[model samples]
Target: MKRPSLVLCCALLGIVPTACGPGSDPDPGVDRGDSSTVDLEHLAITVSGRAAVFPEAARLLEAQGQPVPSLDGVVLTVEEPLRVGVSDADSVLGQGGIGADGGFSVSEVPVRDIHLSLAASLQQEGFVRSSTIIFDTAFTRTRPHTDIIDARAWALPNAFHDALTRSIGDASIRAHSGERASTLRDAGFILGRVVDAAGAPVAGARVVLDRDDLAGRVYYPAPDFQSATQDGTSATGLFVYVHSGTAAETFSLSIEGTQAYLPRNAGATPGLGLVLTLYPGNVSP
Candidate 1:
């Protein structure tokens, strides 16, 4: 009896409820159509030899993470300067700085084939150590990095190669004020930083370890290629390892955070350690 009156009253009021009703399709919110970029930057590059080994002449970048050495006047060809153009060949990103360590760096470069034309100065000391480099700007998540022999039928018994194989860097081998005979031992080095796509340090990233830089070198310190941290680690800036001798100095490091190279002169000990942080928008850490 009361049901009839209640039903009529509810129907008249038009009350609608869904506390126990079937769910419907989710609401499609208004999407502002705009393009967003991941903001990836070119992989940083570094070297540990005389200048003019990279971007000067036509030399192939052995690995994707290899640094382009600074060889400005060193010119690839006596006729043309070492042009640092993108793989697209439209605009030329500015030249990277050549530090005292004879290394060059481009903080923000597109991930593309960096061509160094040095046909004119091929025979030069450090112009074309290997060959022209073909690289990709993609972040290194899968394969780490490897050095290519870059040997051609052109030069045999390369003096530099011989010196490196014999562990005779800085042939003159001067002794600094605080340097010692142990300094001549050639303790291998490890250098790197943790960075992001926007050239920023990303801390809290587990750092990993690898020795790809030392593979195939005739000698342990065969010129360039250091090892380092590779476990999930939040970088804390330049980490240096202090070990006893050159015998145990093989550190090829890669970081989930931004990468940075520790200059040779910058370190006083044999094994070097480093940790770098990454911030949003690739800001420097």
Candidate 2:
């Protein structure tokens, strides 16, 4: 049997699917133009972290009893204004070489910009990088200093190539229609992880949005990449959702279609990290 289209699923459930038509602009709230420039202090700081192979690929290999790939040759560049994990601006802070064990550090780096500090994955030909962690800087009074980054990338594994092909297909369609590629960068984003009672990442569990209007605004990593499954959560348990408008949004979350989990009445906001824990379905949240 054929699977349902994501747009159709949302529409059937009373959620407005963004851009349901071919080359349609689903979200009007996304800022199509450049963000306003704000003058801020540039503080030089140290940034360091591990650049591991995408956990999903690793899991796929390990499950099949294959040797996992090494982190030896991947190069990571620190770029300013993390444009949804990929950078377009010319501003770059520094670059670090990954060790065999996926560990690296950059010292005396100048500027602690929001996107730059996340250790933007640079050119590693034939590899697609997943979104890295976004850390808060000194500008915010709450937990300033982001000196560490943990990131993952896929090395053209068959499964990843399949997903990439879907993404390229979507981009090709938009390009053919003369519409700029949609990355949802203008929309506010919420980054999160889902885990079970054992504190282990729940690979296949889906995070269902409670509100009807939030449909079609969420993506696994970003709008450009297509997830391998309709669950919209990656094998490593990361998920993201875009806000419908310019304002920050707080949305309720629940686990769908699984009797194994009883989700809490959790809430998440854009521009921050959220972790949702699931109790046993037989247990109370």
Candidate 3:
């Protein structure tokens, strides 16, 4: 699939991608220090939450009216910086996978006023190795840590909620101290599918979303176009784009290939789903 430039991709998503380079801190190894001698003022944080299955997989399950697959193999990582007199050091607080019951625990996390980063990863066949990150989670001992997952409130398609809830049960997770709860009101996403003239799934097509107002452009199989080899086309021909913008915005969807699809101009909304049928003729973007 042909890819667009990074600047164009970030603009479409309306996000400034975080830069990682040689000067950046390395992964914080898991902390396993004894808790007995820890300062009495610090509290151990316990984080539990559910993982959403892959988007295409969720859609397939929904179409079949089957139960969403379990996230038993999904892994969750929690990290916070170790602060010195002035500098902060890299340190991983805890990491674990979701249990069969859909719950996960990261015990004995040291209490600190730090920027917490939580990430969840799911690896399974027929689905891309997917991972989502929530950064800058403000954590404190005074705040309830039981609902850590709820606090992150990563925007996900509504169709995936059933499986997520079944895996993690109860969506009322807590946020770290001084953090605001994530609500659907602050969410935005785009769902779409590509098919050939015969209505069969089309894989390896480059999908792009260009903002109507020239605000930015978003490219599918993101991070870079070359990564598309690994992130390209799901088994179901479905593509999902989740962003931090409001649903009120508008965008024009484009497919980079010899053929063109219908309904090029689309509304960017929380649950908007677009079905594009490829034709034989090429259309200019």
Residue pairs of candidate 3 with colliding backbone atoms? 11-216, 11-217, 12-216, 12-217, 12-218, 147-174
Q: What is candidate 3's lDDT per residue for 77-142, written digit by digit as tens?
A: 554211111123533555777767666666665434332233333334333323333222211112
User: Model 1 reaches what TM-score against the true structure?
Assistant: 0.22
TM-score of each: 0.22, 0.46, 0.32
lDDT per residue (tens digit) for residues 123-173 in model 2: 454443333433322112121132333323223244443443354344432
Q: Looking at candidate 2, what is the lDDT of residue 126?
A: 43
- Write down the lDDT of every candidate, Cα atoms only: 0.25, 0.42, 0.37
Which 10-residue window of candidate 3 scores lowest in summed lDDT? 169-178
Give candidate 2 misplaced runs (Cα > 4 Å).
1-42, 62-67, 81-88, 112-117, 129-131, 137-146, 149-193, 196-199, 203-214, 217-285
lDDT of 1 by residue, 12-105 (tens): 3233221121232211111112212222232222111223442211122434343544344332211111121111243243333334544333
How much is the lDDT of residue 195 in candidate 3?
64
Q: How would the candidate models be sorted by TM-score, starting from the highest?
A: 2, 3, 1
Candidate 2, residue 277: lDDT: 31
Best candidate according to TM-score: 2
